[model samples]
Target chain A: MAHILLIDDDAGLVDANKLVLEAKGHEVSVAYTGDDAWKLLEKRRPDLLVMDVMMEEFTSGFELARDVSIKFPDMPVLMLTGVQEHMRSDWKFDEDKDADWLPVRKFLAKPIPPTKLAEEIEAALKAAKEKKGKRPS
Target chain B: MAVSEKLKVIVCDDEPKMCSAIKIILDGFRPEVRTLGVEAELEVSLVSTGEELLTRMETDPADLVLLDYKLPGISGMDILGRFSEEKRETAVIIMTAYANIETAIQATRLGSFDFLAKPCTPEEVRYTVKKAAHHLIVSRHARLLAQEKKRIRFQFISVLAHELKAPINTFDAYLDVMRDMTLGKDMTAYAGIIAKCSERTDGMRKMIADLLDLTRIESGQFRRAPAALEVAGALAAAAEGVAAEAARRGIKLETEGAGLLVEADPSEVGMILNNLFTNAVKYNRDGGLVRASAAADGGKVRITVEDTGIGMEKKDAARLFSEFVRIKNRATIGIPGSGLGLAIARKLALQAGGDIEVESEPGKGSRFTLSLPAPGSIDLKAA
Candidate 1:
């Protein structure tokens, strides 16, 4: 089971998602803002990060993702946002083009099924593990 | 526009008599300007040379300039060319004894508002100046309106998207937890989630209603049915709506004073009261005290909602009532709010011939005072 850090400004979403992830036997911790998430990450790194794009500021999650990539290169980052196409059309979060700068392994649009969220988190964790294994130690 | 902005007009001519003649004519038109019902004041300044004119323009730019095309130092055509090149908004009127079609056409192309012969009739001066004033005011307003529209549309899209999507995001998660029976076994285990889901749905409904009311009020389309409303009844009613949440949070909710009456729409007052009430509870520390009081102060009925919550800095409180402004800090991180509540509440209050004011100190508490015109006050439509 992966230890996941879920960061979102909405407490309702944070609490509900934490329960779902915990039910699946994964350890989960939640932060209500990007800053709080960053502070928590500094204390103890999670195996994976699931964060919302819009929080304290528009690109706060992306900023946190970049920091994570620089600090904990092996930890996978998953982006979750709501109505992204409508709110921020400029940042599509497609890994093919956005991977270079976004520093995230997966992008899940909002109102996503719980199954899909869990599936993506698992896939991302597995991908990171494989990438780590290939690296010269 | 009902704007009291002064329109500065500068007259530059080498001739002293010509300067006074133009100034006297324009100055005499002031009373007639008021009589014509155009709400603009003209402040005329006369400069005998272009050097002084340029210096004064640098210090205090004139909205309109009357220049002699054949003057010494800086010819009116040369200055006109410079004004257009620099893109100053000053409307130039080129006057000359040697008025010719070629010069007039060239001046017109150089961006002069109008061309006139050396001795212009008062009627000609008045009419041209009047047209220039209209052009200046209307064009400035148009430019500002265009800019404001763009900004509002961008902000409106983002705010609407976030507000609408937040609840849906939460609702989706809650349903997912329910469907998978993540909590499992006991149906009662899901009851809290169900209730929270309902609350999110209710929040969204309130947001939608507030958005509609906000748009209608801003567009002057909101139909307000004003009646004599007793402050105590409305205050109690608003408190009743938040009683459960207040009790759950362990907040002490109380109200004082009675018999204070104001003429306003019931729904409008209810919305204002509920907004202040909800915010007081939502932002308050658990087990905090919230006191709502009403009284007649001067000729207005004032309702004050004081909360022992996480009060903001003086600067934050100043912009607290603006659109979509949520104080983002560790203290307020998990608070669920539309951020449009106080904005709409203040708007409704103002339209009903009232205003919402705030007084607060960080960590101590906050007091939001909403004042409405007492009964027998002037009509609200005047606003």
Candidate 2:
């Protein structure tokens, strides 16, 4: 339905997500780091961005998302994080509190099932289109 | 409290009769005092004024001081201040004629163990001295236990890094290879499972790297390969490595001071500079600047990293070098960090006969200065 760009340091996770998105009949591009994702953004823009919070640097994905929001305003971002459990902090994404800093349309913890991941992709894409329509044209 | 040892109790009373009376009462309380780890025979030192007490303390510091407030030259209040400043573990029991609530509060604030009125009975003196001795033993044990806990924690982190990170890294790499395999339709069903495994392994990998970094610095491994190297060369090498990333962010990276030399392992020097540059780039505002400069002065090579980035609060800076502590706030929320970088860097600097200093303002910028002993400047034989 849409072209999705996935940025993650974990090659296997990127592959798995790519497979699920492709099976759902969407084109997917994978980037192994924030730097790679930025370089790719130079040549082409995807319908949506899916990224892990920690990559080559722990906050790389978050910074990349902020950059995207500034440069590619209409592009939606979905964040995947794997640090909460390891940090032993009871952290959850609160839209109102985190919206300004996180700037992501959707946040997902790691290990999402393929079916659920596809659903999230579809939901994110639909929301992005709605947001774009609401913007003064 | 151990019953077999002896306690050295110093009694400072201007009156000889008063001292003799307290000594007689202490002799009777010997069995009770010995229970607080004092020897069966009490080693008692009797002094008449603060001057005599100070001289006696120099020769043989007592476990407990039974002090008189009205001394000839230095008042007991002054001696208390001196003892607190010296951080002497010796407990002081002030015997005062002005044993009002105010004097007691003043004495206690000066760290007196207890206060006794001038006409206090032999029994009162004996009981107060015994309690002071016991308090000393308990606090001494607590101080030792606190030190022991710190040592154990350092050992635990070192062991975890050394034992756990390698295998996890190997397993993570293998998982990546598996994901790369073109197994077509059959592998689709297991894609989610493979991805989950990969993410878990990757988390372990990051943790292990941080752990190893912490252990290497804590265990004095940085000093393992010491050699004379150019400080500016190490800075250039580190800057070159991160140049691409800095450019991608539209940040400027500049380095100067070409020939300053220091006695340190090149790799360790590289690591210290790399960490500083990475932080300067990572923490800076978009399109901000990072400048690194090195110089030799007073037999030390000083390298400074200055950045136009989000600076930190002075209070936060105090705890920055402690493990597992990261600066937490909105500006830092999106920035990921292990919180061990500065701590490890400081340890490495120490091992390399150097140190790191930081200067920052909330929004202006930050400057980190690392200094290492210049080659031939420090006496190797003495070290």
iRMS values for every prediction: 1.8, 9.7
Q: Which DockQ values do the candidates obtain, in the order shown?
A: 0.45, 0.06
lDDT of 1 by residue, B1-383 (tens): 34355789999999999999988898745422332234567899899888888899889999989898888888888888888998998999889999889999999999999987867798988888887887777676678899999998988887787678778877888888888888997999998898888888787787787788789989989778888888889999999999999999899999875878888889889989999999899889999988999888787888999999999888888889998788877788666676788999889988888899999888878999999988877665664
Q: List the global CA lDDT of all models.
A: 0.84, 0.77
Lowest lDDT block of 10, candidate 2 chain B: B162-171
**B-chain TM-score, candidate 1:** 0.65
Evaluated on CA atoms against the true complex, candidate 2 attains a DockQ of: 0.06
Best by lDDT: 1
In candidate 1, what are the lDDT values of residues A15-106, reduced to their tens digit?
88788888889999888777788899999989999998878788888888898899987788888876456655655667789887988888
lDDT for A136 in candidate 2 is 92
List model 2 lDDT by residue over B244-323, tens digit each: 98999999988987877888877777877888898898899989999999887798988899999999999877877777
lDDT of candidate 1 at residue B212, scale 0 to 100: 82
Query: What TM-score does model 1 achieve against the real structure?
Result: 0.68
